[model samples]
Target: MDRITVLLADDNLIVRSGVRALLSRDEGLEVVGEAGDLESLIALAEELAPQVIVTDIRMPPTFNDEGIEGAKIVRKRSPGTGVVVLSQYDDPEYAVGLLTEGASGYAYLLKERIGDGGQLSRAIREVAGGGSMLDPEIVSALVSPAKDSSGLNAEQQRLLLQVGEGKAVKAIAAVTGQTPGAVDRAIGELFLVLARDASVGGKDALRRLRSLHTAILEREEQGETLSRMLPSKLAAKLRADPTASSRTERLTVTVVMSDVRGYSGIAERSDPGALAQQLNAHRQQMNAAVLSEDGTVMQYVGDAVMAVFGAPDPQPDHAERAVRTSLRMHELQRALDAEWQKEGLEPFGMGIGLSTGLVAAALLGSAERVEYTLVGDTVNLSQRLQDLARPAGTTVASESTVTAAGDRWQWEALGDHLVKGRDTPVAAYRLTTDTTRTEPTPSREEATR
Candidate 1:
């Protein structure tokens, strides 16, 4: 007979209004209060002690990761309360992070799906009943080949899979007929298996847990969830030194970069809201394609995406996977164009490039400012390839990538090209759908006009 109390946190008034309107139609749900930023959300969560706190990823002030941080605060302060995170984007890393505390009473939904009242209500009820929910898109992103070898055990993997589907640990336990204690123990064991120590007690344990929680939550909140924050080069080196007690492994990877064609022109011509919607659509399509091919999207840079293969987890076929993903991304762009045309919008295209090489992959920055990213010539080359894609009218790749790809893809040698910073001229290639044809040569006028 009692209504489910809900605290809504979102910087956007319209989104909050829309969510409130949708939930209002449901008799079992009640909106307790609304907060426009992380601080207010945290304070309200503490004060209201709502059954569930639903929040958006972006909020006021820094707008970087307020929602996720607020979620952490709520989890720490009100263990009895549930948290549901909503975002326009599907970032699996965030879901993983939120569910890391055992995937009970946690949910992540794509904002676009708010219109689906039934789905939204189901998610709310699921989390309220100590269940988890994640957008299908987020699940796909987290299961990529690059993440396949993250060394997660059966229990952790199962937890992730269940959480991805928005099923809570309690629900999972009920299905498996495992006791709640057993499920909780399994999650704790998983944290240990991930090289995170759970032995330390008191303030140290709490601090570590908070740190880990923040790391995972911020990723989801900032749309950077796919990548794991690793220690910085200096810290890693220090940890790896024989004199130091800490030990960690380093990984090599291939980086892929994709940028929208004529993005600046589009942004300049379109309203901010329209441009954002367009970019969001483009990112959704690109993310789906990339995840389907088993690659991790590291970050979104304005109109571009930085993705990686074989760092968080190494695969012998990482280079090949990255190449295949680039090809598929081209197809995705075309598909998106058709969708745009149907909606009476102008079609825009995407350019993607990939490069493979060694890099020190790890979480970089201070404890308060850490981010997981790859650093090396390979990353730089990938960006350069994205830039080179313009005049060629297709994705381009460095010679190293071509060699790595072998005969699987059709590539035409563009000859040794000069790239900034490197003394030696790097051989570049124009990626083509057809391997039989020689590389096409276009005049300056043709390329420009």
Candidate 2:
């Protein structure tokens, strides 16, 4: 069993010690670090990258909403880390403010409710999994103030409650035994009904409902931050032209797909909390590698990382950039793995695949959630080649990618191999580095096939 890593923050040393002591009793939880102020909290968050952060809503320097501000910064910097805010006051306003940006990966609890530590433990676990939790009193405080003068039916009011709790459409559908489309329609209709009611109380309820509804919708996307999720410069273009993502464009680009070689075996043997920390570290390094070459990190699903070297902004040397990026990734991971080995943790080995061809790229989704994606055979081939890249730290590139990248490194022809979803076999090349050469030596070998 893996203990959940946590960071505690409070201006008062006694309070911090007491809370830490309480959490220490739980064998499943581990305190990795502590901070007394907002600045220290942010610094430790970036350094330790703990699974969860438990902090006082007020801290030193200002003692006013520092915890909330610090949590926001930590979340932006490390989107995977969850936050549980402890406050002496049970004011719903602070909770609302903390959650205004988004409610997922956030929890607000009254400090007085930490009697048995069960509630605090539960909240920590909830937000750690990208779920939201609010103190019962805070929920009541929020709901009681917003009078239901909009004349919502029983079913509609129930729907409102579920939405207020930050439940996703799919989750709500499963619970209510309704289709996702039906749930979405119901929510839209519910919003329309609220809009129709213009009474003072109705307006208050409507405002709160709108905020909650938006937050819940945004939760569907990973990172819960739209700007951060998009490719570099794509967000700016979308903002300048809101409809830029509405249409598809054909582009000649290079796609890179990398996956941890033995993630499943590692997961089965390692503690869940420790594995999460390791994964976060791996991802941060991979992200830096990709960004260093101006590649866009499309997504990180579990142990897999998908990146694109051209699309939102095309480059003539996309293939070369991807090849360089792949090598850099392997280099960075090796250093990271060395550090992990020192910590008595298993190091990660990545198998990367690169494919270059024409792909139809589009930003798809509704106003609430959107994803920039590449579609077509190019994308599929990259994933297929990635499967062929085994034995760890190896990179496989498609024939097309090899041609576009030019002769910069030695190549080992993989020959024509049949891949899934295709009737014909695809040609691939292994990007080989010379152990003798300190720098990349331009070379190419003729394939006899």
Candidate 3:
């Protein structure tokens, strides 16, 4: 990694030398220039355009707030440059003034705490990465009184302090040992609580909260987009290393495919709005079932849903998980159908299939659009197996899946049959939805799409 180039600005020659010495100890940081006054600071900032600026709160030739004012001017000239204001004063107003415009790449640290065990180095690195940091003392001084007036408990007040310090939701989640989604919901609830409590400066608090929240979200949007498109675990991996998905890898996995039975006829007979609602409800139920089993829902092609287990993150019990998810999908849809029937909506019957084998999986597409997809016979066989599944709410598995699942569920053999896109017959098994119901022979028409 390249070292973080920094420009140091302080009126005191001893202070500037000490700060430079501190930064020099870390090979990852380099002091590019030194400025002792507002005019020289602004001049060097424009000339050097360093990644970060470490400046004292007061400088020469009118020593009141020149550090902050000059830093602001540098940032305005080069929006990408980060500023860390080192202040001997822990007054909340200084911190607020430094961050009033925005807090994306800013830091406020007490000069007293600068010598405390790599704290200054960490702050410099953080701001260099477009993340902000606040002195713990400053954060506490800023938000301590809001505890009672803001209607927040101890834990909520702690969370408020982290937010005020410009921590991202992901960072907050890491610190609190909670999921990002949970942290987001907590912050939203905190906002509601603050909005309800009428206290002095409540409006200012809300404005700052809104601004900080937006900055955190905007910083993590790539991860957020990946989360919506892929599994949470997979998204985090990609977020940490963007190149993780670039290469294809082969792994043992189970592919699942499900389709709404008689979907064409249902669509033809039902009203468009009602059918769309039912389809939306059906997809939601399917998503919930798959996610509960830790499966990745790949796509929804009209009435068909495709899912995979094992790739992106390996799971040894992938076959069992896929089978369990398929059963759960059927059960959930049955319950949803019962409710839809009461509203005079046609019920949707589902046929699902599972196949287990080694397949190549990778995230593919251009910069504009991409998808995590599985390749090989396993994916194709799952679709073919779904077509062979007879009756509603039935799940069919290939011989490989049945073997991999290892007698977890009693299976009824569906005699070897020639499937489309294959020369030889593929053996299949059904996890009997109804014990008494006999197997129906698949006709030539049923075998084709």
Candidate 4:
């Protein structure tokens, strides 16, 4: 790690020297310049171009908001320079005001707490690395009065506070007993929600969001994109119950099982490169369709895509959503197949199954590779129904799914068939509506495009 260049600014000479002495003690920090007033601070910032500027919240002739004004000017002039504001009071408004331009590369700490362990050093390091931190005293003061007004529950507020205090994703996860991926997803969602609030100030919200995004993206020491593994809602659930992770709950949900028909034959006959491309495109289309309807993709096993609607986060219309997703998936596959054919590639045919009933859902396996698993008749029956779609491009649903989905679809009763797992026969329904209508998607290409 390169040493962080620091510039100290304060009206009092004693305070400036003390800060410089404290920060210089760390080999990672280098005190390059000092300023006693706002004018000098701005001049030295331009002259030295320090990586970080540690200054009092109020200073100079007026002693009003010169520190903040100077910091903003410095930020505008030097794009990546971090500003650390030291205040004598516990007011959250000062910290709030400092973050008006943007949240990236900023920190606010009470001057009295500078001697409390390594608070000053931590703030400097956090701000230097494009992270924001607020004093705990300031956060506590703000969280209490706005709890009921903002509609944020206790957990959300706690998470927000942790973010504001400059805790890294893994740090927050450790404190909350949640996975780091879950914390990263929750923070992104929280900031977007907060950014839309008229009272929160859009610029400030965006700043917080931008800073958080930067922090989370760089949290992994090995530079891994860890947060992309799970659905946002699933990650939120992981954060919601970090302690009760492995507990199973009997919940009613809509399960979707899909597989590429004749995948074995296609893989054996087609070129390796072409088959890989086709499978990749198929998965992308399927994932888009499932996520568009707020469904969590359970996993992709070979050419099979399994998705679930409802569990990890409750959706009242899980069955309906599942049906809609199945329809969309079929349509999306058609569009992808058309494109693939135009490029002289083999087309993929998919068979889907939907079943709505009670299933036991739980966070299973271990932390290294945690997974959301569903077990019960619903899951088994759904797989059986998928196998029943012999000709492909068709979605078969269970009777319970048809009932829960109401009269939304033109259902063709497939009658009763004995599923592999059960002794008794199960009545099934096939969605007779044309699945290849080609629903207009927002974009022509995937993210990799």
Question: What is the Cα-based lDDT of residue 409 in candidate 3?
Answer: 64
Q: Estimate each model's TM-score.
A: 0.49, 0.62, 0.52, 0.51
In terms of lDDT, the poorest run of 10 residues in model 4 is 440-449
lDDT of 2: 0.83
lDDT of 3 by residue, 48-143 (tens): 568799999898889899999998998887666888999999886787788777665788899888989999999887777666777888766655
Best by TM-score: 2
For candidate 3, list the clashing residue pairs, or say none. none
lDDT of 1 by residue, 1-449 (tens): 54677899999999899999999999888887999998899888865567789998888888877898889888886564677899876755566556665555677888888666478788787677555566777666654322343566676777655543435455668988998568757756654554442232223333333333343333332222112222222333333462431323355666889988887777677765445556656776677777776677787778788888885667778877887787777777787778778876666777777788888765556645556667778888888777778642377887667666655666666778778777778777777653222443342224324
> Tens-digit lDDT track for model 4 on 308-395?
9988777889998998999899899989889878878777898999999888887666556656688888988899999887678989
Candidate 3 segments exceeding 4 Å error: 1-228, 433-449
Candidate whose lDDT is highest: 2
Cα deviation of 388, candidate 2, in Å:
1.7
- Which ten residues in a row are the worst by lDDT in model 1? 222-231
lDDT of 1 at 376: 78
- TM-score of candidate 1 on Cα atoms, chains taken together: 0.49
**Count of clashes in candidate 3:** 0
Please identify which of the two predictions, 2 or 3, would achieve the higher lDDT against the true structure. Answer: 2
User: Which residue pairs show collisions in model 1?
Assistant: 94-220, 131-168, 132-166, 132-167, 132-168, 133-166, 145-294, 230-363
RMSD of each: 17.1, 8.1, 20.6, 16.8
Model 3: per-residue Cα lDDT at residue 95: 78
